[model samples]
Target chain A: MKVRWRVLGGEWQETDTEAKTVGELMASLGLSAEEYLPSIGGKLVTEDEELKEGTEVTFIPVVSGG
Target chain B: MVSCSVCGKPAIYSAKYEGKAYCGEHFLEWFDRRVRKTIRKYRMFGSKEHIVVAVSGGKDSLAALHYVKKLSKRVPGWTVEALLIDEGIRGYRDVTVKDFKRCAEEWGVPYRIVSFKEEIGATLDDIVKKGAEAGLPYQPCTYCGVFRRYLLNKAAREMGATVLVTGHNLDDEVQTFMMNIMRHDVERLARLGPVTGISGQEGFVRRVKIFYEVPEKEVVVYSVLNGFFPEFVECPYARLGFRWDLRHYINLLEEKYPGTKYMILKSLLDIAEAVRKGKGGTPKRCTVCGEPSTKDVCRACELKALLGIG
Candidate 1:
């Protein structure tokens, strides 16, 4: 499966992966679930959710404002 | 693929609370409309008012500043400006101040920068250092929160701003509401609202939260989509306080049960309304700074006195 992941204001990277769950894909991309929220197909997805092929996920920073 | 609820375009955001997805264009439109709705609902300001937005070089504050700047153009006789407070934290604040300045310049909003050292006779670093040396029992945030409010209000008033705006979103507000409830501080809880600071009070600027109802995640998404995103830098002292724990706890709840934050805020507002009707004592002027206070001196003045600074 291919997944496109990107940070806000950063370049998008398309990668081929064998990850089954969202958590696996995030780990494969070296992202922390605590720090980055993953939205799959425009909806927030939990780590347990099964990742489909060619899904576009945008990882948003979870840092709160003061 | 999910399409936008309004227009059948590829969706970029799913507002879980609203149960709707929006494309980039529709999301921006929805975000702006929600902000405008908050303004109108709270009656934050009107035409011929000078609105001062507090920018901390964070995404939330910058997003609030951007939206207010956009909203000002449509409101006749309304003007928008930015205020940045340099807390004088060596590495952390220096970077954000630069980001704030750049955003203000880019947005063409007039801005003023104030510092803790200049206004309160000590930088936050100096305060933390001295507080440790002096064996103060309170945390650094106690001093920072007090002094920041003092400086923001003073600067906004000096600039003739009719309203002082902050980027406090649903998460901040809900976390604060929960913290207050857990502490059982009715006095503080009574003050929580979309709009605060009593009007016609001398030295007190009416403060409004433009993104009060918007979730933190949506604010980040909005900032990114609109190209107004700032550098994500967490305050070094943020995790040292109770609010940090509350924030994470609230985030957990929000993640598990969507719209939990909004429900908390709604409950708080209802409780606040009930408390307001029963509360009667008016605020007194602080003897030291002449600011409104429930006691003889304001919290900022009391903290300053404890720190042995002006």
Candidate 2:
């Protein structure tokens, strides 16, 4: 299935992959290991969870804390 | 003919450092080394983490951000993120908005912009309005200092930034130091230093001033030689007139005495230590925001209420 992934400040891109898990989608996106699990719409979605066709993810970089 | 005093070579002796003479090569080398040493001595950004730069879209911030990007890439263990706060200065914010947006794109650091109007109830202009209502010609910079800090701190915490770096340099510090001297604000001087961390605040990030020790001229040279400023206009409300006078006064003192910044910092450190030693009470939690504060409300909250915010 084709899933849509959009990056903030960048245009959305679609990818074709056979992988059903969020972890697999992330692997396809070229995310490095150091990147933390991001909270999508306020909940942290882990690698094992399955991603749907139209799910949106927000990657909050872990920097800038007071 | 005697050797020049500045770079110690044969050149026409001129009046910069008391009729000093030096070759062009020595002069450039001396200036370069001074910039490097000051950068290192102040420990501007720690080598281990990605640096989050706070730019106001002004010359000082733009220069600082650009230089840090160049220097960090050359030195390992250095990464950068650029953050800008649009204080909504009439034409100024709009003028620099596009450039600031493009700056991070040019440098390739994931950038975030938080507007003053969006995050807080008022832009800097609004703060001055409320402040002016009290019949005080209080500095816009003072309100800007407070608002900018709160915005940055909240944004930093939200992003989990390790180091919050600013563009404050020697001249600003020297001017502030002179202000402290005029007011005899020994405690304030002490609390102000290269790196500052408010006490008893668990989530408070450490603030570092990389250019804290560098002279104002070096920063100006770094900017002019490089010629890129996202925006260049004094704040519309910089009507205090005193701060500008203070700046000139410090420059005059610096002409007669170099290293005045170091002297002021030295005095500040002494007072900071004294304040740390039994000078402050256990800071109570602010009733409003629950952040650590000795008083019922934090300065941010107080100012927020002044604007009729919750």
Candidate 3:
């Protein structure tokens, strides 16, 4: 499957990976659930949510302050 | 393909708390409308009031400033300006100050900066060093928070602003509520709301959190989509604070059960309302700075005396 991951204020890249779940994909990228909020196709997806081909995922940091 | 919950278009953000997906156009619309709703619901400011937006060069404040600036254009007689406080963190704050000034210039908002060194005769670095040497019981954030609030309010009032708008989003509010609960600080919790500070109080300007209902992730996405996303930098001192631990724990809960942040905030509001009704006391002026205070000496004044700063 091809997953496009965009990190806010950072970079966007496409990768072809065999990961089947959102959690697996995040683990492959060395990302943690505690730090980043992940959404697939504009809807927040859980770690167990199955990833489909050509899904666009965005990662946003969970912490912000003024 | 998922569609926007409001309109039939490619959705760009899924607001889990609201259980709604929004396309770029609709998302911005939804976000702005919700902000307006918060303002109206809280009666934060009048249409003709001057608003001082506290910008930290972070995503949250920048977005708040941008949105308020945009809203000011439509609201007749409204004026918006930006204020930045330089806490004097050597490596961290200097960079964010530059980002803040650049954005303020780009947005054409009149801006002013106040610093700890100029206002208090000591930089935060000096305070931390002296605090460590003096063996102060509190962390650096304790001093920073008290002084920042003091400076922000003073500067806003000096600018003749009736309302001081901050970028505290839902995540920050919830974490603070939880922290207060854990510490059993009822007075501090009572003061938490979308808007705070009593009107007609001397030396007190109303402070409103425009993004109180909005989540942190949504603020980032809004900042990113609107071309306001600056590089993210966490305060070096923040890592050592209890709030940091609370933030991580809250985020974990939010991930497992979406809308947990909002639920916490809702409960806090209810409790805060009850506390406010039960408590009736006027704010006293700080003896040192003449600012509104709950105690004989304000927190800022207390910290300054501890640091031996003028």
Judging by DockQ against the true structure, name the best candidate.
3
Of candidates 3 and 1, the better by TM-score: 3
Predicted complexes: DockQ each: 0.23, 0.01, 0.30
lDDT of 1 by residue, B1-310 (tens): 5678899876665666667888778888888888889989998887789999998898889999988898787888988989999888887888788888888888899999999999999999899988888888878788888888889999999999889999998878887788888988887788889988655677789999999998887787787777766776668888888988777777666656777778888899999888877762476788888877777888988877878887
Best candidate (score: TM-score): 3
Across all candidates, the chain A TM-score values are 0.83, 0.63, 0.84
lDDT of prediction 3: 0.83
**lDDT of model 3 at residue B158?**
98
Which stretches in model 1 have alpha-carbon errors above 4 Å?
A1-58
**Candidate 2 C-alpha lDDT tens digits along B60-177:** 6766788778778777987778788887677667766676666667777677788878877678777678777866545777767667877786787667677777877766766676
Query: lDDT (0-100) at residue A25 of candidate 3?
Result: 89
Query: Interface root mean square deviation of every model, in Å?
Result: 5.2, 25.0, 4.8
User: What order do you get sorting by TM-score, best first?
Assistant: 3, 1, 2
Steric clash pairs (candidate 1): none
lDDT of 1 by residue, A1-35 (tens): 88788865478889899998777888888775545
Which segments of candidate 2 are over 4 A away from where they belong? A1-66, B1-47, B134-137, B229-231, B256-262, B278-285, B292-296
**At residue A34, what lDDT does model 3 achieve?**
55
Q: What order do you get sorting by lDDT, best first? A: 3, 1, 2
| Candidate 3: Cα lDDT at B70 | 87
